[model samples]
Target: MAEWDIRKLQILRTLRDRGTVTATAEALHMTPSAVSQQLTNLSRQLGVELLQAHGRRVRLTDAARLVLRHAEAVFEQLERADAELAAHARGDAGEVRVGAFSTAVSALVVPAVTTLRNTHPAITVRVREAEAQEAYELLQAGEVDLALSLAAHAPTAADPRFTRVPLLADPLDVALPQDHPLASAEEPRLADLAAEPWIYGSSGPWSDITRAACEAAGFRPHQAHAAAGWTAILAMVEAGMGVALVPRMAAVPRDGVVMRELRADRPARHVVAAVRTGAGEGGAVGRVLEALRRAAGAPAHEPPLPGPARPPGCPVGG
Candidate 1:
């Protein structure tokens, strides 16, 4: 059996095109001696005289020409392979796993997925609902390709292990019971509600945002109730248990809950899409990130409709 080295073949091809050892060496960034040594080794390996001297220049022999012809085909095939790989990386056809928190899933991820399905059907997106910490864990573990999280919970931009792409600054609005004194206020001042008992998330990013916003308004909230999910928190507000701060992304107009924009101390969560360092550039991940940015920027008059029926084993949440 005969063996051929692709690197050596490449050197030979360069030599044939350049028509001189010196020119070939210059083209390949090799010393002339090194280029000659490679050609000598390739000739010995192939058992053929691949070059012939013609005065001050060298030319490919008939045997060398035959091999070069085949080498050209091999080069073309390799180029085609590279192009296909790039297409796959660009999400032309492949799967992207995403992890996101619930509101982000409803606000950003689902709309991005729907857009991808329409625009790039060959790319499949699998989603899982996870909180900020859980989403980061899933991303680090390689369980998901992208994570949507509050920027406060995401790693800093200087972190070399991940790329954080900002999607939106989702403002926190005041959720008041319809009959509350300030419910109809065009722009209720946060400081004015400093004495109001507040409903807040029991823990996690939402709770952190709530506490921080209240503190910025010059007082710690009188946390009347702690609930985990937005639905429950909103329900509590609707029942007049207490007022609450709701992120714009999670706000839903309900019968008894009136949402009012804050006049001052307008706190907002920065939402960002995160990926493993270098993963978000020019691939399916990049495409999905773009879709998310578009979805986040567009007005959301209503929450996303329920996503298409889930296939068995499909994870849901964000």
Candidate 2:
């Protein structure tokens, strides 16, 4: 069939609705002969019988019925496009599809979304939680507009295809059971955790890093549970099934679980926002990125107040 036109599709739909040319013309404010001519033109273009008259009424051919269904959907899509365009023009609405890795979702994504709501309040933000690598792929495929990624270190600007924004460096921490021997040890070394059954997150960059940390400690960890995310790992730790090394920001202590610094020599990994070259700027995605930046820039921990000091010659405030 030749490419369809909006007017022809609308006329076919009107005929289907009004059941005849005369009634369709009355509804559309067009003459019956004009509507019939348009239908004939459409039938000629498609090389098919689109309609047939029966006594005082007209009905669609099977092919015409099928095409009309698709036409109805196309018109609905056009209407949606119009509504979305109007919303965009007014800056009152737009949809942003965002992807974030598991840890980032728990640690920063929620707060970031809250920040977005408080700041823009007009944009509709949809989030998909996935592993970092998967999320990156989704961003690359245009399935998502922005991805929250974790990098063990800063990324080199070798690829201009994406604009990488540094958000925060979230440090790693060791999760242990509440009463585990290592849990009570202040500044526990990585070696202290070696012999314990380790619960690792399912295979990923972070898992590699965790294993590397264990290998550096000179003992292979006993893999007890392989969980999906920090919460699962922590749940295992709380159940006293195994220990895990997790990002400090996302490894909040739960009942029966304890979190301590990793005390490793490696620098913290950065949680970053990755956007396709030209996709995320100056829209809902941009606003969301700003909100995430604000959340990631939040202080790691509250500083403690210092105790009062005594003068060199004075007795202590005793």
Candidate 3:
């Protein structure tokens, strides 16, 4: 007869995932020595070697791989047990933690929280602002019940660990100094800005969006200025330093900048709500997801936002 500690298996799984004891310790909030100690204990419990030294790192042994495959089934059944309980629960009366990016907090999560207050008044929601990568990490560590993430940085659709729900397209619009020539066009083509100096983040998703859009338009951008904050980027555009692409949800009226839709192929960032696979079936998580969908579908003004709109007059910061 043998007994297995789920905690030790978790450590082993994390080591398999992260490739180093240090990284596994960091992810699990344990010391590297503690991680090694736990794995050594796991080896004794299972009566098999679980890891082999490989260069500076360790590699999972064949026995460890076999154990992991079975452990995954054990985890699935445990989640199903919780799901069965949740399916029969009557009230949604517990705190739910959410992690989201800054802009999504304002445009999506805020409105959803407001509605949850009125509709499911017993539900208390806690919100944390984090970009995509950090948010997913928090999700994996079980710190948040849900994460609002972007398509560019989310896990692949096939990833078995989390469930992805499409929330918004959040089309990209060109922010121009009000006096720019193409600001007057019905729909400006991205190609027309090939020669203009660009303003974007020094790194991260915004820079990726700007670069991908421009390169797709058949030219590379000349980044003359770098700013990560939307306010700073818009301010630079207002001061006429350079043009920048902004998400529709993040574009706000600032008096000297006009936001316009691009002509043919418009670039956009996709937003999604992610939760651990079976956890999405719980009453609180399910209710919150419905609220997010409603918030995302609401009109583009004020709280909650709309998709791309072709304005009669130039919209945004005019």
Model 2: lowest-lDDT 10 consecutive positions? 309-318
Assess each prediction's global lDDT (C-alpha) against the native: 0.75, 0.68, 0.80
Single out the weakest 10-residue window by summed lDDT for candidate 3.
Answer: 309-318
Candidate order (TM-score): 3, 1, 2
Give the worst 10-residue stretch by lDDT in candidate 1. 305-314
lDDT (Cα, 0-100) at 230 in candidate 1:
78
lDDT of 1 by residue, 1-318 (tens): 446878899889778656789988876789999998998898889899988989988788999888877776675465445445766666377778999988899888989989988988887899999877789877765689888886666765434346677667777788999999998776688888888989986766667767777777788998889987778988999999999888888888899999998856656777777776556655576678788888988442222211122222111121
| Model 3, span 163-267: residue lDDT tens | 777676787889999999998998789999999999998786677768878888899999999998889999999999999999888898989999998758667
Q: For each candidate, how many residue pairs have backbone atoms clashing (under 3 Å)?
A: 1, 0, 3
lDDT of 2 by residue, 1-57 (tens): 376878987788778756779888876789999999999999988788999888887
Off by over 4 Å in 1: 1-91, 298-318
Model 1 TM-score is 0.66
Residue 307 of candidate 2: its Cα lDDT?
18
